[model samples]
Target: MPRAVTLIRSTALSDVAEYAYAATAPADARLIFLAGACPLNEDGSTAAVGDYAGQAAKAVENMRTALGAAGAGLDDVISTRVLVASARQEDLVTAWKVVRNAFGDHDVPSTLLGVTVLGYADQLVEIEGVAAVLDS
Candidate 1:
């Protein structure tokens, strides 16, 4: 099946960033707005305490599961916002590296943020995503 999502890269924009600068989905596509996927295990505990990279990986894994349940996948994702609970740029970069590697060549548009705290105890990372899929 053909994907509805299209990632846009611009020659005018700097190519230093790992992901595309923008993306779009056709009007007929089904939009999937996923909740923030936290670094939590199935049992409700945080998966990686005090480990930014590990927590980011777990969050990406959870995001993938959520997308699959919604009849989408990483390739169908149009954009994402990654939240890391930290005041340090290094911490945010650590989390972003994991997420970027997870997406690989799909490289959807993304925003990385560093916040003071997250919802769950010992939670270090959360990923929010929007995916579009054609349903025909």
Candidate 2:
């Protein structure tokens, strides 16, 4: 099996991301798109209300569960879209910190969006991801 890893960078953007990703990955690779995951606990209740950090953590955990169902993990994620209800810079930074800690050294391509509200009344954050299953 052969694998390739590419890190896109540009002076215009501090974060690493390609202007455009490869239209098609290698043959035999399986692609997976997880649904938007919210900060809901296993009991079907919001994990944290008005707490970006806690919501971010729970959202990531939900994302992991969705990825696992598709035979993928956090490391396999190629891209992510994070949604936060608050547009405040401090709130955004705090949520991003949680995501960064979860990803650690792997800086997966991501887009963070700040919105005025979400589907749930108490939900503060949501996360979704795309992953590729490598051929063994």
Candidate 3:
């Protein structure tokens, strides 16, 4: 069965269709706590060095992999936290676009944060998400 995801909207918040102010899942949903996903390459090295777009995509891909392990997909994602080093406007926008592509029109609630540094040396983006998989 497909997971039930509902996007909540309020007049106090911005009307961004790609993002939701809040999201809810079924009461019986299994919540999956994920580790921060980074932009790692196939060789286990960090990809998108100095490239926000590539890094964002890689990070999202990692999240997807983690969700798959939990028997869920992007549709099951209810919330996401995005961390970007330096927090440049262009960098944030570039990273966000890549993330949006990964989640498509799911309208997953998200928080974008700017940090001084991340766990990795050259990593510019890190994303963590909470997903719920409902039992049939």
Candidate 4:
């Protein structure tokens, strides 16, 4: 099936960023707005306490599960916002690297943020995403 999401790259924009600068989907495509995927285990405990990259990976896994339930995949994602609990740029970069690797060549438009805290205890990362998919 043809993908509904299209990642946009701008030559005018510096190529330093790991992800695309923008993305768009056709009007008829079904849009899936996912809640922030947290680094929580199935038992309600935090998956990776005090570990930025680990938490980010867990969040990405949860995000994938949510997207699958909504009939979409990572490739269908048009944009993402990654929230990391830290004042350090290195911490945010660690989380961003995990997410960027997960998306591979898809490289959806993304925003990485550093926040003071997250909802769950020991939760260091959360990922919110928007995906577009066409119904058969």
Compared with the true structure, what per-residue lDDT tens digits does model 4 show for residues 1-136?
Answer: 9999988999999999999999999999999999999998888899979999999999999999999999999999999999999999999999999999999999999999999998999889999999999999
Worst 10 residues of 3 by lDDT: 9-18
- For each of the candidates, the C-alpha root-mean-square deviation to the true structure, in angstroms, is 0.6, 3.2, 1.5, 0.6
lDDT of 4: 0.95
For model 4, which pairs clash? none
Query: In model 2, what is the error at residue 131, expressed in angstroms?
Result: 0.6
Candidate 2 displacement at residue 28 in angstroms: 2.5
Winner on lDDT (3 vs 4): 4
lDDT, candidate 1, 3-118, per-residue tens: 99899999999999999999999999999999999999999999979999999999999999999999989999999999999999999999999999999999999999999999
Model 3 per-residue lDDT at 35: 92
Q: After superposition, how far is residue 4 of candidate 1 from its true place, in Å?
A: 0.7
Candidates arranged by lDDT, highest first = 1, 4, 3, 2
Model 3 lDDT on a 0 to 1 scale: 0.85
- Which pairs clash in the backbone of model 2? none
lDDT, candidate 4, at 81: 97
lDDT of 2 by residue, 13-82 (tens): 5444422232234556788888888999888889888799999999999888888887777777777788
Query: What's the CA error at residue 15 for candidate 2, in Å?
Result: 5.9
- Per-prediction TM-score to the true structure, in the order listed: 0.98, 0.83, 0.92, 0.98
Q: Cα deviation of 66 in candidate 4 (Å)?
A: 0.3
Model 4 misplaced stretches (Cα beyond 4 Å):
none
